[model samples]
Target: MTIEKTETINITSPLDIETVEKLHAGDRVLLSGVIYVARDAAHKRLVHALDQGEELPFDPKGQTLYYMGPSPAPPGRKIGSVGPTTSTRMDSYTPRLLAAGVRAMIGKGSRSAEVRESIKEYKAVYFVATGGAGALLHRTIKNVEPVAYEDLGAEAVLRLLVEDFPLIVANDIYGGDVFEQGRAEYRRGGN
Candidate 1:
């Protein structure tokens, strides 16, 4: 599918409202700096913590959470293949997390309506990483450290320092949605 004049942008994680608000759907980004990794199980624990009125393991404010469970690292590597998982799996808990101040999310696939609504309402953004490019993505990760829920192993929350990690802005705070836009364009083209 053709994206209309995709612009390459460089951004950092733990992004603030100002940074997130400026992104638009279909823009390509090279994300650097810090990001937190978590999958379904960790998401559940995080939401449960919120429900109990307990503090989250890490501050969600101005943060980006990557939905992935990395494989074991090979010798002489800081991390293993770290690719995105289907985003819909976290749809149920996304709004709550957004409300808690998460600024962005990185994963593959489209999100639910509620999640999209929350993205606009909370002034956040959603990014899509290249799915099957884990090894390439792994090369960008410079460091990794266990952050929380270590017992969950690969599913645990981990802090990663990445440089020029590639992604596309799929949903923006202004309600721009790349997936829907692409579909509409395809239909218009009689494909």
Candidate 2:
């Protein structure tokens, strides 16, 4: 499919259902604004808190979660080598988060069938941050502060303020899956 010059979109965080519904798999996005960071350990804690009906550090509604575990900041930097983790690791907890009002997620790799269903059901979207591009990605991050699960170290939940954070829509509310389409195209030797 040929993309038009206006296909790329620039968006800010705390995306609502209407904005997420407008996105489609394979669309390029330049996202700015606040996003929450969490990985395996942090997800576990959040899910546990939800199960126990405890208050979470941040509201999930209209929020975006980046599946990442960043390395410690060196000296004067706001962060270190921050990159996306394999999204599948968080699959078990994703539906709960989506149900709790998380509207978007950033990570690498394909997600489970259940998660995709939840995305459609919740009118949410999933985005892919390029893997192995930590250094470049870090440059887009303007600030970072730990928000919860501090004892988890690199796995702690963090609030990040980013400007023009790059991403590709991997899954969209309309049920598009870029990973599947890309694989099919490659199998047919179609660029």
Candidate 3:
């Protein structure tokens, strides 16, 4: 079923668990409004940007950062094989970003305890996409445009406009995690 919300979700954290739990895997979400884009290299620079007292490229408040490193797209395509990468690499930068007011993250796989704790302390949610589904994922992305950090190449940050982006709920404000849920549910021999 397609889950749709027309009103731009004005998320003012500390986010609530109930609100986050409502989201689930295979949900079709249209996230509008503002969000920050951070990859491995860019994240490091952001941490230092803080130390330098420089204004962040984008405000973290009421925003989400998608952890994806898109392949260089062929001409006439919005994006190329855009998919979520490993999340652990960003573990170190996540807490700080959360502290700065990031409310959600879109990526694949599990994150470290430090990141999960930050989610609880900061009231954030972690959204995961199925691995090895780039072709499927791309179908959900309706638009793509570059946003700062272009000098970093494809690793450059970008503001993507997605239409009914499909995703799974990995972690949420309440500490509910899909990665764990599946393990416990299937371990009992449900499969």
Alpha-carbon TM-score of each model against the true structure: 0.94, 0.94, 0.81
Candidate 3 C-alpha error for residue 142, in Å: 2.6
Candidate 1 residues 83-169, lDDT tens each? 999999999999999999998999999999999999999999999999988988988899998999999998999999998888999
- Model 3: how far residue 157 lies from native, Å: 0.9
Write down the lDDT that model 1 would get.
Answer: 0.92
**RMSD to true structure for each model, in Å:** 2.8, 3.1, 4.4
Clashing pairs in 3: none
lDDT of 2 by residue, 1-191 (tens): 13343767989999976788789999999899999999999999999999999988999999999999988899999899887999999999999999998999999999999999999999999999989889888888999988998889989999999998888999998899999999887785434
Least well predicted 10-residue stretch by lDDT in candidate 2: 1-10
Compose the digit string of candidate 3's lDDT tens values, residues 83-144.
78888899989998888777788888889988998987887788776667787777766677
TM-score of 3: 0.81
**Candidate 1 TM-score to native:** 0.94
What do the candidate models score in CA lDDT, each in turn? 0.92, 0.92, 0.72
